[model samples]
Target: MPSLVPPVLPGGALSGREQPTLYADGALTLRPFRPADAPAVALAFTDPAIQRWHTHAMASADEAVAWINQWRVHWAAERAASWAVTDADDALVGRVGLREINLFDGVAEVAYWVLPEARGRGVVVRATEALARWSFEELGLHRLTLRHSTLNQPSCRAAEKAGFALEGVERSALLHTDGWHDMHLHARLTDLA
Candidate 1:
């Protein structure tokens, strides 16, 4: 028996074409991750903040390379997509990506983090806005959600600046190294009108 409503986005919606490099602004670009970026990724995991929130650390460059390789698989599978956030000179400054993509529902979760040097520069906000635009317009997604620990003030601020509205808090929704954290759920819908 078929359901009355069909998938909002059909299969091959993302895998049909190559993942294109997205321009966030004159100063920032979102591009596919390269093997050379393993070092930067390994270095990023060493940051306590990244480790604490993300709950995983790359112990070596090899591990980072493997992690980078999986993004291609995820893209082909249409389950997720990730990009390296680079500066104008093409230096890896951060990362932004969509995870838990569901074509049927046309939704995905957004995640992002920046190197210590890249913080306070609004890089995440710009990258997120660019991703959101592509997700809604090019990918035909219905909704994009951004969630972060309530303690993560910077992430909360960035989510708001990127036009994600705060829906509510999920109490003790995530487990961190320290303890359970309350998560703030924010969302941006394609049809805001």
Candidate 2:
């Protein structure tokens, strides 16, 4: 009989890094989403900016809970890592995560969004920077990429501020409610030189 257990990484998990309970830097903290955050999560999706980019309008708290639950599955499967961005008061401010993670290739895509009230407060930028650093220093990722609609200037700025250089634009890369949209790609390498 063949063994069913898969090999684990140095941390005894497939992710190859310790999943810390919290990541904080002064005013911002990144922690796993909890069930209590459902109302906030549902409300966030109602914002015009979130709707325009995310394209998923969460209609109820139940839907938000389901989404939150899925994040745990993603983390366990080593497919992605998501964190709830919180402020000094522990209020949910935004979210940041690594998606499309290809551990074998040491590459992952970073994604984030700030709640309407959190916009212009540098929450996204700070969270992204912290996550990128963790990806490189802790997860041993060689590269991290971020992509956003070419029309999302704030996203572009966040990526830039996190040290991700603009790579190029892909036309019609994603289909949204308004039809195909061009995407701007940016990337950062563990070794800048």
Candidate 3:
């Protein structure tokens, strides 16, 4: 029920006021994730596509609650943060997060996934782009990175369309459900800044 717009600030992007909550190609409001979002998160993770690409088991309702709760702890430490991406109707369609923040290097790894219902509609692309821009500009981060198993074409495409250039492939980088395989690393720098 709370507003998603940022607080007042004076500067370039944040100049004189808020950077738009929305950005990129579609519903780009990457706002803070709330505890109340647990139900939707639980539902989204339950989807087959999400579970497959994530290479993990589904989360129970309580696990989803703890996951959402950690967003606050991560935010407080400036180590990482997560946001719920919503449609104009304010239904949560996905989530994106900046994880493993390295302040000494001013970098963070970004991750995201769209619910099956939201895929192919540019939801993840918009959310990721918004999060990347915020990371480089608002958070003063120098770099943001993302990774996906090469077998996941949709995720790789979303990353590319969101302005992340494919960096390289790490062969046998992870043990996915399909098997140990390469991971495509992608990134967007602070060049716009």
User: Which of the predicted structures, 2 or 3, would earn the higher lDDT when compared with the native?
Assistant: 2
Query: Would you list the clashing residue pairs of candidate 1?
Result: none
Q: What digit string (tens of lDDT, one per residue) describes model 2 on residues 1-193?
A: 7647532223324444446655656689898899999999999999989999978899999999999999988888888888999998889999999898876667889988889888997788788888887778766788899999999998898889888999999999999899999999999998961
Candidate 1 to native Cα RMSD, angstroms: 1.0
- Top TM-score prediction, candidate number: 1
Measured against the true structure, the TM-scores of the candidates, in listed sequence, are: 0.98, 0.90, 0.83
lDDT of 3 by residue, 28-121 (tens): 5677777777888888877878887777654677788888878776666666777888887778888888888776566778888888777778
lDDT of 1: 0.95
Clash total of candidate 3: 1
Residue 148 CA displacement from its true place in model 3, Å: 0.3
- Weakest 10 consecutive residues of candidate 3 by summed lDDT: 7-16
**Clashing pairs in model 2?**
none
Candidate 3 Cα errors over 4 Å, as ranges: 1-25
Q: What do the candidate models score in CA lDDT, each in turn?
A: 0.95, 0.84, 0.76
> Candidate 3: RMSD over Cα atoms?
8.1
